[model samples]
Target: MKLEDLRGRLMAVDKKFKEMYEGLERNKIKSIIYDKMGKPVSLKKLSGYEIENITEKRGIVGVDGSINSYGGIYPHYISLIQSMAKSTLPKEEDIILQDVYVPLFEDEDGQAEDELKRRARMSKLELQAASFAMESFSSKVIFMDGSLMHYGIDCPSEWKKFKEKAISTGKIIIGITEEVKTKDIAEILKTELNLNDSILYDREVLFGILNEGEMLEFRRDLKSKKSESGIKSCYVRLSEDPQVAGLDFIEEQYVEALKYADLIYTLTPEKGRGIPLWLDIVDKEVKVTDEMVKSLVESTISREIREMLLNPKRSKRG
Candidate 1:
């Protein structure tokens, strides 16, 4: 198809998109959200949750994980998982951990085994780091990289351990997704708005939907549907950017979770992506760079091992 043809094909759905947006507006989607199970809240701290109290007494801890693989194919590749949990408090030190997994001995019969193994390993490592952070730091709040539901789904046992630890310790743990991937609100609104044929993710449905400094929450039924056991989620537009973010909370601690919204929003920049600036710092620190991985492999694994077990055929092509 020509460029004009491509443009025309894309434009074919414009009417539907526009009508959907109009329908949401006509129905007062924000109020509908209130009735459904969530309360939209402004980015203001509740009493005793002021900036000084947040930054000093109840410092926010950011936990994030990174994974990198060297080599090709299932059996030949080695995956490295690194997670970091760092407190926003200047006095507290960073908690960093690493795990490496190679599928040399593990039998990979299915195509998905490699992917599953890597993700599970990474999730487990992240949760482990988070649990460690809870014990090491006096800070009561932790902001994890992804949704709480993802941790449970990806690594249930580790999630259970981490959840129990946070609960017993009287600490708060929240998951922040830089890019919202949930579809619960979209599905519910699609039904409510009488758009049965529509298909939309939360990302598309919520684009520019939330007002600046506002968050979208929903009812208990939708919360249970969208989350795994013990987890709940909401969407927040913390910055001037139209893009929104997902914030997941522990079910019982959701009240406490909402109270921290102001603190998080305070850390987010108007000119930046919706994520808090501190979490972005943790992300950069936690990432396992290519140079680091290369140095690690070369220093630890000998030449024969590298040739036989580590290097993929693609490495030699050039």
Candidate 2:
């Protein structure tokens, strides 16, 4: 019962969850197509959703970040056009991909720690904004910028609603993560369902391409951490059974996931190039760039903080 033993046990369980999920759910997969503008016109049509924005609430929002580095606010939009799916393959010609912009903000309090608190705050703001848009236009679906579990931890209200609806429909909600571990989604599911262990699996999933140069930054960070102290691990883990498939499988696997959706679009930032998610069938790296993460971080609390600062809190002591 040592602390390290317990931590190692948790990590082992995390690995087991990921391996199990990937092993079980690789066959059921689908994909989506979008245009350069980040609009899912082709996907909406493919999913049998109204192409003309028939629902007053049909649209995707991209977020990005603005940082005051060197005393100047630098706003960067994570940019990219993406297509998603579960088991079905997209006709290369039919894929009209679009770029989305999402912002990630800097955590004023924990910037020194490089804490991912911004991800939480930005996710909450994005959900709030998306929810307001949904209410304003009475939209049927809101394609959030990232994975479902990220939102659950960041914005519990929307996550609860999303889970209830997706489960009621017998639909597995798809979550895309710039980071690969499935821990966020699994945690949310376990908490929501109150299950000590439940079987979930990854269907057809695709990992976008990454070259050595593309991963250099990650290498540097990893190397730096090798000699650093007080560095907490952010590595995530999940439980799902997935099957192994080739890149060609992307079309076939994602198509199935698409069948469950009325519309499929990218609600993530364009910066990181694209957002990556786990595919049980493919046993390789699926890369979404850092640009996208930056976007969501930026958009999270920019306006809200400004407004809050302007409206000072009433003090009881005063």
Candidate 3:
């Protein structure tokens, strides 16, 4: 069958399964945690949790740390328990987040593409982390923070291997990118709006642990005048439909990497507010506390920025 035809059929199947699962009385969704090396780790089993560890490799970096230099290596962990349509007890199959860390390196010859390839390699480590988490508790789905493919760069073989391994195990792999025009937004504001590129340079700018209220603010900015244009791609490896048994969703594209994937899922929302809201699904039921989001946001941002600044170009002093 043609690719489009296959996808449509899969979507139909997925929708059916989702409807079926929605009606079942399931209890508690389990979330898996993975480190930068893809090894699974124990996380506090709280819905809205903020975990911080001071590793010998990465310091006790908060979401507010720098993104481009040396510091502690950190990754974001998010697990949300979605309420099925039918309310029996409470289903325990939850989604796990693999916020992989990419190390910073100097690229003088415009080898930013290489950085993306490196990021793909870094993701392999995250997959290992997922595997370890799965060994302990069964999770319904794994939600990755980025794409299966390397963005703006050719994909490496490891990316394909990691993605396919996740699919064969009957676990859904859902990838989400909230802002499609992230690079463009950074550039546009850098030029048109005269926003500082230093904003991107700040290693602490990207990470955040936002509550429902703060999430709402970010979502508002995402859809309003602060809205940026680009493709926030979503990809799934299970069935194209959300109802299917093995539905994996990837929001971004890969030239050859996706070819190895059995089912690819995508949904282009008119508004780019799904991520923070989706995160709120479990946050509301748990009555998430302020400290949860605060610590997470601060640590994630700080760690990411410091990583980006790993190998900066030195300025020549007179």
Against the true structure, whose lDDT is highest? 1
Candidate 1: Cα lDDT at 35: 77
Query: What are the per-residue Cα lDDT tens digits for candidate 2 across 1-318?
Result: 569989999999999867655532222211111111011112222223453343333333222212211111222223333332212122211111223432334433444233244355445444444334333432243333344445555666765664454434433333333334333223433444354466432121222212111110112123222114211111111111122111110111233434323332221122322332213211121123455544544555475653433222332237
What is the Cα-based TM-score of model 2?
0.30
Tens-digit per-residue lDDT, 1-318, candidate 3:
359988999999999756533422212111110111012111121111211111112111000000121223222122111111111113433323333233233333344554454454444444544454334334434444443333223334554555555556644444444333234223333343344433431111112211111110111123312122212221111211121111113323222222222211112121334332332343343332345444554565665653454313342233
**Which should have the higher lDDT, number 2 or number 3?**
2
TM-score of each: 0.86, 0.30, 0.30
Q: How does model 3 score by TM-score? A: 0.30
- TM-score of structure candidate 1: 0.86
Better candidate number, 1 or 3, judged by lDDT: 1
Models sorted by TM-score, best on top: 1, 2, 3
Model 2 CA deviation exceeding 4 Å by range = 1-114, 155-179, 183-262, 265-318
* Candidate 1 overall lDDT versus native: 0.80
* Worst 10-residue lDDT window, candidate 1: 23-32
lDDT to native, each model: 0.80, 0.32, 0.30
Ranking by lDDT: 1, 2, 3
Model 1: per-residue Cα lDDT over 1-318, one tens digit each: 359987887797786678656655633665556677577777753345567676557577899999887777778877778999998778888888999988886776565876787788888888888888888888888888878887777888888888888888978998888887777777887887786776677787677767888987766666555465767778899888988898888887888777788888888888888888889999999999988888888888889988988788888996
Candidates 1 and 2, the one with greater lDDT: 1
Clashes of each: 5, 100, 73
